[model samples]
Target: MNDLELGVIGNCAVAALIDRDARVLWYCLPRFDGDPVFHALLGAPKDASDDGVFAIELEDHVHSWQSYVENTAVLQTELHGKQGSLRITDFAPRLFWRERLFYPQAIVRRLTPISGSPRIRIRLRPRFDYGASAPIRTYGSHHIRYVGPSATIRLTTNAPIDFIRDETFFNLRAPIDLILGPDETLQEGVVETAGRLEERTTDYWRNWTHRLAIPFEFQDAVIRAAVTLKLCTYEPTGAIVAALTTSIPEGPGTQRNWDYRFCWLRDSYFVVRALNRLSAVRKMENYFRWLMNVVASLHETDIQPVYGIGLESALVERTVPGLPGYRGMGPVRVGNQAYEHSQHDNCGNVILGVAQMFVDRRLLSPPGHEDFLRLEELGRKALQLYDKPDAGMWEYRTRASIHTTSSLMCWAAADRLARIAGHIGETQRAGEWRSHADRMKQVILERSWSHKRQSFVESFDGEFLDAGVLLMTEVGFIDPHDPRMAATVKQLEKVLGRGPHMMRYEAADDFGMPGTAFNTCSFWRIDALARMGRVEEAREYFEEMLKLRNRLGLMSEDVDPKTGEMWGNYPQTYSLVGIVNCAMRLTRSWESVT
Candidate 1:
């Protein structure tokens, strides 16, 4: 199956969607950040067809359909047969202690018969380190071992599994059980099997969903988006990844692939805002603490745009030469190089996130935390380079430019610095930062806005419409109803809007290359319209964009308008945040109208 054709299956505890052909397309084994055990999706190796590392044949099945139990993450898939039906329910349960702490590892997939008893076949192929390492497997009663370089996977099945050369295959006519544990040694039949695993998974998700302060009319969509966002989070660290799978191409047959498994500083900012909107302020606060910890340990100059789940800074980009790119997009790469790029927007993002934490309704003060001091020092450093050209928010591959949106972010950083100083009674420093912020605003207004075009240009000299301009109102750089914003909105509509969806920009006109239409830009347009009191238009557009979510209510980085296929990385945290933020804003706007 193609990338877009893959299906998803999993309960809130643990769920994975097997394709129509029976390949585990996406899964986070042991923990969400653990290296992939089956990563054929990245790309097929040169020896894939011959060596059979990347190819797996599916059993002939009549039909298949998958769904989650209502308000729960427990996923159920029914496979039809000539005699009867085979059903599989998957979940990864949260083992809460007396303290109710969350554990990170454990994925359970249970297979049973739902209708007339039919024989079900199962296969276990374990590939470690993004399919680069092979493990030594030893099998015994209800237990199997696959040892690798850094980690070991112990597979246990309730039923007998036939051992092949390296893979395991078995047939079951009755209910069978399976357990996959990572990094831990396993004893035969050692785990206490919960008779009500499925029920517990259902209750876990239902209770979690009940906590959401959902006010939107489209309640289901909002809940699903929120769940997808939760699924992408690294619960232990409070770090949210950009997406689940890596190397999902942005364009067909292109090398615009990236590994999004790591947490991005920019994404955490949005996660905080989204969780706060759901009235789950504690989680957001935990993330703020995580951010504080990250910044506190690093020098002001050592701050990176992204970091590993453990806050590791050694993110050297390297390509897996043997593995082909996803869907023939060559050169599967891991470890982002953007970490090394001079993305000035990160400082602004950190400042904004910190300011939001203080301003949020559920505010908690981190006593004696050095992170805020470090962040303030970095903000000051960023101000020193306010006029120097640097990579903008988009992180374009070419030379840096004086991007207007990035400059606006710098203005936001200084503005927030001023606010933070005022909160701490540092009036002198606050005034200095306020003066710097005013200077940036003046420079942006003078150099970024184009009177001839009657809108804000993409950069200092480029004459084009950039959907990022919509952020001006959101970031408080300009009034939402300002005439300049209206003109910019008009320009965006004329240039970037394709029906109800919006592109990041006219890629051909500005970025010099065409790309898939960005999904988040659509949300920005909705926010802009709602802020401008275009309530009716904003509601209509918001509803229209909601139609683009996948059957599982997940969204990618971009979309293919003609085919309605989600492109880019799957389950993108930014897209989910956009959905939640826009929906919340739209709901509030509608309330104002009523």
Candidate 2:
């Protein structure tokens, strides 16, 4: 009965997912796309031979509860056994120190007794190179180092070394600290370092969330979603990952699983947009720098749909056969092949993502004339290929179409560049960009509209309906009040909506058909409905979508609409961004409270 019911804890450098029973099921070392140190999440079915787990087994545990410490990424899980009860606090140390962000690549766990004496067993098994090799364990007086083929990690703790080594049960009389991090000795005592980091990390998150201008309604859900999105961001390179894990299937045996641990420019656009709406501009600022580097590196090459977190352009896709996939499905992909595809919409997304930085006066390092000049290159590229064929946003491997999604985004690119040029006093440049946008708009309107289907089709002169085109009103490409906009929404829901959840499309692609509902498309539907003045209907659908989230108010990339079961990658950044965007759109204004 394994599911995506998991809690995430990270310091933006590293992240891990812990199940309801407090097992660290998924974790990557050093960085987000690095070797998975804990791979139990994609291990053998039923965890039959899971050698990548770090679990604390209570002797007679019967019940448990898990949640994030309010307004923070710190996770608190309590376990109740026949003998007694205990609480586990998990977080990666992150805080501000010496005027710099001091977020180490570490996972800190503190065990505290809650009731009568509870005994627990520590099972610390780590793997390397996608579970291909096991680590050799060597113990010191107060630490145990797990040495792998290429890397090593040490568990510096105050707990008894022999008890952890032999997987023996120990009494829960007081608090103990266990820090898993770089293979090095602690500068301070284990207790002092963990305690100091815990206090500071908790403070850091609370202060961060407190600054967010969240909607009055659904405040808790919005904060949680915002925190999840931030955790998915790699602070060093400022590249935001699509999700934390790889190879979680979109549907049972669909073999639709793909690695989501890298940055997709398209997804990054939505993530920063949502965060910007909440006034959480730090992410956008970091992303602007990352995008700057990405753009600078695109010398004589077309922009990729995705890139490695470290800004490495060639993300050669491959499978890791050593590890069985989620629920026994195979083909655990590592790098994303979308890096090789020509997704034309990405240029528009990049422009739209950074355009705000030009207008916002508050950004510390606003883009200057040079940055705008760099973006104009993307604008030119978008206009050149706006009507041409590519994979589209869905990343269809076998087919290429003049996708309306691609065209609309290119239109967005031209549109934003024109506006940016005007704001920057480049009137002549603005006029030229404006003409490019207007011409593309007319062509898109003429070619993408389907009189036969009574709606806007997915691609040029194509009748297949797609959820991607629902962005007409979202990116300011079209007014919501336009008659065609309403018809488009109606037709999309008719063909793609499964109950309240929306599928990416009804048309089949390389995978035959998409079985599960794409969560972000459903949120887009809510957005379209709200903008069309169907506020009540949008609120109804939004609530329905919220129910689909796990107990921790977290969601994945897709879900089983029929059974309300979550599928796909866990804690998807796209899905979390949806929660923020929809809540922001639907919630009542704070002035109403007064």
Candidate 3:
């Protein structure tokens, strides 16, 4: 079966997922939202084998192991056979050159035989435009080019071009270098370029890891998660994609698949917050600039739930009929229509991400008066929409309700703006923002609380339970010690919790009941439990959640509560953030080790 124990290798420009046996199964070109150069991950059920895959196969393969080179996006897979053993090192070249980041839309694969003669076959079948067409190939003495409708990629390698073109096996006598990238030919020799990039990329990542303030416990896991998050970020525009691939269903046959290639304001807020915990705020600072551009672009328009990485506003979602979905699940999709939905909490999330600039002394360009004025515009929108009806964070398709989580975030926006105002010594503006926040809080307390249900409800004056409101404590909407919060947690778990996993909610919407538990909701539950002094229980539950991760310590958007099968998009940013946040919360302090 196709699995997500897949290792990811990429620069911020583009990424690809390689399976345990060193097959490039999924990759988007030029940018995160670009067309799939490799579509094997979404291969049809009938074609179970590598249909559109780029793989290096060892003859009579017996044993295989895969891992990242320490603190780097480079992936190493060791394959052993009875005759010999070889190592495959894969990475997308990203390193500092001439005092700037040199991240290209390229992949570098180096094959080295570590033992006796190991023969291997090269299968490079790249599909284009979502597997709708095959590339027309042409070759030179040292390179082969695949030209498709949308893009063209060149394979520059030291290996025999005829052998690679014909998909034949050859003996591994010496090191072979394959650089798949833009159609242009490289000036330097293939071996020299690959060697230089591998060395510099290693240094770049190790330097980055050295600067992070990771906790002593689970340092490897934390670093891996952090690296994955960084790989998801599109550095050109400072937009971080939720995941590299789209149409990986939330659960099997649930039809809960949605495209996550675009940036959601709400998700970005959590991403920056989690990275900030590790003292990695460079991405956050760049993201702040991006958010500023996004907010400025919407001079009069209301903020949407998601936007294109380049801040393109219109994302009319549609299914790609040509490609079967992941594991032959149909309805492969692209372009999320949630961009058109009215997710009122969006303004609050944008403001929250931007508010970080005013306080972090490390930032070179902190928020000035004009920045505060622009934020006040978002604050006004939050206050205007807090009590209004629209889709909540889950982006329910069929209905609209006064979601309590939306209101709480609006309260957060106002609360933070007020604090920001005070920090700038704008006492009058501070008081005004505070008054708005207070009013929103009072209304939320009055409407969302359910005395009959003995808990806070999902929506205003509705008794439905939602896992989102369990974040009341984490977001500072309510103290964990408060009886109402405790009651809400208890009732939420009763309704949504299955073992250690928690469903986002219980109600049906555009789809039927969710088949898998939303991973981040459970992590939020862990945080809430920790804040409520259920540390022992929280630790036990955290361990349970950890078991749900794949062998690589990676998670998807959701997991089957019964089968523990990972579902939804692979290496989801929200899921990764959950891992980092929960680890930081539950791990013993560094001083304890001292």
Candidate 4:
């Protein structure tokens, strides 16, 4: 399926999903949360088709191969036919120009013939209002403008405008450049401008990648994951989205799809941590600003689980009626309603993210006393809410449990705050924070343990085993060598682990059974095994999980255990974070590589 065979190109401003054959299947304009200009990834049905897709299809398509330019977001797709072969180099213009970051909300698709003549057709179908209406088209000598209900998109190309407008086939004569961007007239010729931008963009990315501190093993995979994480960041606000796409189902024909094009405190925390390991501190600095603004915007101490990339608090989830779901699955959702849920893990996550600013002396400006004081507000909230029942990390709507993971994060928050207070010379405050952490840990240790289940249950006094508890050792809730932690890991593996994959939890949520295994949960198990001195087993498991990644070494949020098909949103940050974290923990010393 084209959905599985996709590569992404972006410039931290906007992104597009292009299939193996160099077709722009899905792209939102202006920003990640903006209207879908090319929405064909979510096909209409078997009977009809959706507009807003850009594709250059060869008459007799034989084979295709796609890959990213090394250490860059640029993608190259090669298509072959009996007649001839063609290559399309795609990228969004992002480079240092005039001593400033020049990132435009545009996609550059440069098509060149490699062999003999090939017949090709250009289909530039753009819709507006989330595929609700088709755009009205008008063309000139070298440009075409599609005016939609809300915004207009212009396509400037060196190719014949008549052939493109009429969707007619033409023989490959020379290289053509198509610059699809905001509704603006191009002053320069297409080929010349695009050629310069491509070279500059390539240079810019290579320079950025050169600065990363990657592990010895899995260097290529780590670099790709790092670049993908950079693309997910919204440079304007420094808010990193959970994923680029809105609603790709977690499982086939299951209504478990949810919009992920928003900032989640928990998810961003892991993202910042992963980037920190790579020494990509610029993203952490930008995300710190985004986090501070989110904290400032909240009226109460209760922070929502998720927010819009622009820090818009009211992310009321709703279904868009027009466009069919990914693979025609239905009920395509836009905004996520998880914002309304009170996930107690949020405050702890924010503190954990902020704690880095205080401790990391390598940062340009290490956090001071004032920053610590600001974080104390969240620490207090975590101390108060950790034991109370809420939606938990999974964002369950039907039932609320005093989730052990939530309680454990509460302890982590208080513990970090206590340390931060000590760093700022607030000994009295440090002691108080430590007291709160100790109290929360006591309650969790006493209440979350189940005698009959022989493990730490999902929630207080419950028999359900959640894969989330597999993080107990990683999060410092318990020592990896502790019997209780070992039992919890073994029990979770029995309940949630299917081969190498692990489910977040087997218990039914607002939906029914989860169709696929959560990607990060399995990685946590690997980390736990390494910490517990099971290094060889952890390495074996880690390698198996790595093999499940797509050809581009990218992963989605979930994977069907039965089949290796990836599900959920494309190139999810959580899945990528797992790759980086596992690689770091499992890699040998840098001295060996040296």
Candidate 5:
């Protein structure tokens, strides 16, 4: 059965998820927010050879082993059979060519026999319009073109065209390379192009990872998390998408699924900040530019929480007609409605996301006085709406509340603006922003504190517990030694703990109670525990959370704490960010690395 146990392979331009048996399950064509070409991650309804997958099946298959090539996004999945074994090397070519980054909209797979003669069948199916239509296929001597409604994809392979077309088993006597890319013909032979690109792509990734100032311990986990977050970024615009897949449900048999393929301002804030910790500032500088465009285009308080990676705003949510959801769950969705949400925190997240650029000299293009004036526009909105009602960070659809998370982020925006102004010798402006920040912080502490429950609550006068309150400590709003900080942590554990994982909150929403623990919140709990002087306990929980990763050391959006099964969107950026943040917080200093 297909699960979230998949390895991701991609350059920044395009990404695909492959299962342990080397099935290309989920691949979006052309771009990250584009149509899904291979939709097997969300199963198709009509099963006449299953219309939305690409796979290589070995005869009498017995077992499979899969992993990423070390320090790289390239994936190698080896299938073992009674007769013999074979390996499939999959990657998207990314390297510097002709003095510019050359990452094409292509996926390359090389198949080689590792043992005695093995027989295999190639299943290359491509769908369009969210699995609503199958592409019309036409082939030449060495390539096949899949013509679709919006785009055309070409499959250029070195294997026998008749064998692939007839779906017949063939003896794996020699190596074959399959290049799935644009409709244009290749300029070189399949073997030559694939070989040069594969070697260069591997080198590019290893070189990138080598530069990261990783944590002394958990180096492997941190490297994988860093790589995964880098993959989430859209290089052309610097917008980081929340995840690769669209409508994987948060839990089983629940209508909690939402398309996470778009860029969320709140999520992008965390992603850029986490990468900045590893000394990878390109994403930050790039994302800062993206944020500037987003803020500049808007007139006033009309900003959105989410948007297309290409900076297109209006993401109208709708369900498609044909494809079944993941694991036979229905209602496959395409666009997201969160763009229409009054998240209220968008201004603050954007400000916080790019605040480092104002003060850090390491950036190539630092924000100037004009940029600070632009950021001040967002600060004004943050202060105006910090006490109003809106969707919280979790984006609850049915209800709007004066969320503490919203208020806290607004405070963070103001606080950071004060720091930035002070850094640039604007003392008067610094004092004015500092006054606004203090006022919001005092109000949040007073209104969000629930004396009845003796802990910080989700919203004003609310009694329900939420894991988001943990950010009070994370964002440096609350002193770690404060008694309420301890009380809030203790109360959260009492209410939201599910085995080793932690739920986002205890309150039921439009979908009733959530059934799974959010993966990011579990890591937040570990961060809170480590800060509360429970280092040993936090270490144990961190170990448990690391065990939650799928075989490729990857995480999704949520998990069934009862079953230890992943259940949300594949390769969530938020969940992966947690891995890097916690590793940085929990590891010993580099001074002691020797």
Candidate 6:
């Protein structure tokens, strides 16, 4: 029996990283956020004989390789056997309607054989809702239906397939020709193939990607990074999720797992900044509108650090049992409880993003004029808590403290409010805000800095270096070339820096165990260096940071330098924004130097 390792069975979706032997190693389906239907990536199933898992086992296959089409989302995997070669292409069609109005659509996988006569096998096992539900599969002439509570998966195969109760198995020889279409038509409860779905999907990406006017240097990498960022966005809410999947371990079995499929206020701001650099205003404008909506709906004291795709205010975290985690990192969790915590930087982040839009793009009058009122209201709330203790940028679940970074953000919020108020002719309010901002700046400089250490501390009472200090320059709190700013950067590099990246801060009782170095902070260091005229150092560090991107030019929340594996969440939005910002900064620097 030839065991092909490249078979992927996702919850109602089929995906795989095909090997030379035509075996699949990684795949999840139905929705990118859905649970594993075939979970071999985590661990082997208890009952391997059941068809409920999709995998390929072929022995004699020689070589395999995988690649994505340039500047596109299509993934292609190829396998070479003694007799011939086989290729598989995978992509999800971009739907016409927005996510709120339409059900999640289909994922298309196409297989073609190019060489000698070799036998191939295919299996599909689907577990729904984080592998908590097992769907019942019913076979048809051209399709197979897997039905479970309120959700239905229909698979259409161009070639013949052998059907089992909850799985589908099939075999093909070299010169194989087959098209696999898996649709998750949950609300509608029916799946149909349109005459021009593929054509439209290809066209959608081609047109969308072409809008990015990127420099020729590293053009391919830049486009892929841009596309990856787009995939992480929740179209309906204009909220970009931090990543596609959660619970992928930072280390082998460390409990550092956290859910990342929700929108973070901080990440949203960076997303806007990144998109703004590309002159892609529609998405950023939509997000700004979403932010305005959030601010409008929130009570004075009920603003959260994060929200869901539907703008749900509550996020109760829960861990799933029975199913093991990715790479044996147990206790996979869904829903983030951090929503209840106070992240002081969030309001400041929002202010900074909007201010950047106004200053850089001249978007003084966004489409919905009412959004300015919402922003003003939110700024007022943030001002009220300027002196209060709360969670800082890193959501340490404990009693609030006057985190230095938080205080800095408060200053940022005040500064932006002053500018915005001035722009809108709120002369009296603008004056008050500016006065308040000056006071906050004075407070941060006085209380947050540690004279003995000659650097800013993490909290008012602590004497530790925080990676967040890198932002002092980025946020314009201090000039990058200032001796004080230079000293702080030196302190962070000496204390928190791990190789090329920097840790958030030293581990403390308030925050959980500090794990790997954060990727965003690493880029922030590059940004700081660039702003300080350390152009060569910034360029070198930026290139080193790019090495952390996965095969798909995607980045995670953190990384284990020793192993080079992604830690924390996969494809973090903040990380991508860092990449975009760093690239743009480097390009700008080059233009200036020339």
- lDDT per residue for candidate 2 within 462-543, as digits (tens), equals 9999998889888998999899989989888888988889999868989888889999999999999999999999999999
- Candidate 5, residue 491: Cα displacement in angstroms equals 0.5
- lDDT string for model 5 (341-384, tens) is 88777777988898889878887798899999988988998989
lDDT score at residue 472, model 4, on the 0-100 scale: 79
Once superposed on the true structure, which residue ranges of model 5 sit more than 4 Å away at CA? Answer: 47-49, 589-594
The candidate with the higher TM-score, 1 or 4, is 4
| Local distance difference test, each candidate | 0.70, 0.92, 0.88, 0.88, 0.90, 0.67
Per-residue CA lDDT of model 3 for 324-383, tens digit only, reads 788777688889989889988888888878777898899877768998888888888888
Q: Taking the tens digit of each residue's C-alpha lDDT, what string does model 1 give over 1-594?
A: 235554444432233545544456556565554566666666444544222121122244688776667776666667786666776766666544356743435656677777775655555665666666667777775678878777777766676655333444334466766666654544334334533555565677888889999865767777877777777666666676777777787767656788887778878777767877888666676677677777776664566788876677767788777666666676777788878877777778778877765545546654232555677776876687666787777777667788887777778889998887777677998899899999889888888888888999878767877898888888889998889889999989888888788888664532355457788888889899999999899999888788887666667888766666677877788888888988888775345755
Which residue pairs clash within candidate 4? 52-125
Better of 2 and 6 by TM-score: 2
* TM per candidate: 0.90, 0.98, 0.98, 0.97, 0.98, 0.87
User: For residues 1-594, what per-residue lDDT tens digits would candidate 6 score against the true structure?
Assistant: 111222221211222333333334334554444455555444444444242354443235787776766656666777676666667666665645554222244555566666665445666665665566677777776567877675666766655645333234333452222233344332321222432444555666777788886754556667777777777666656776666666766555677677776778888788777877777776676676677777777664577888875677777899877567765567787788889998888878877767755544556445333655677776776677766788888887766678888878878888888888787777998998899888888878888788887898887766877888788887888888888888888888888877788778875634355667789999999999899899889888888898877655777777876666677766677888888888888865345654
| Ranked by lDDT, top first | 2, 5, 3, 4, 1, 6
Error of 5 at 164 (Å): 0.8
| Model 4 regions lying over 4 Å from their true place | 45-50, 590-594
State model 6's lDDT.
0.67
Which is the better candidate, 1 or 2, if ranked by TM-score?
2
Clashes of each: 11, 0, 0, 1, 0, 23
Worst 10 residues of 4 by lDDT: 43-52
- Give me the runs in candidate 6 sitting further than 4 Å from their true place: 1-59, 95-104, 163-195, 356-369, 509-513, 588-594
How much does candidate 3 score in TM-score?
A: 0.98
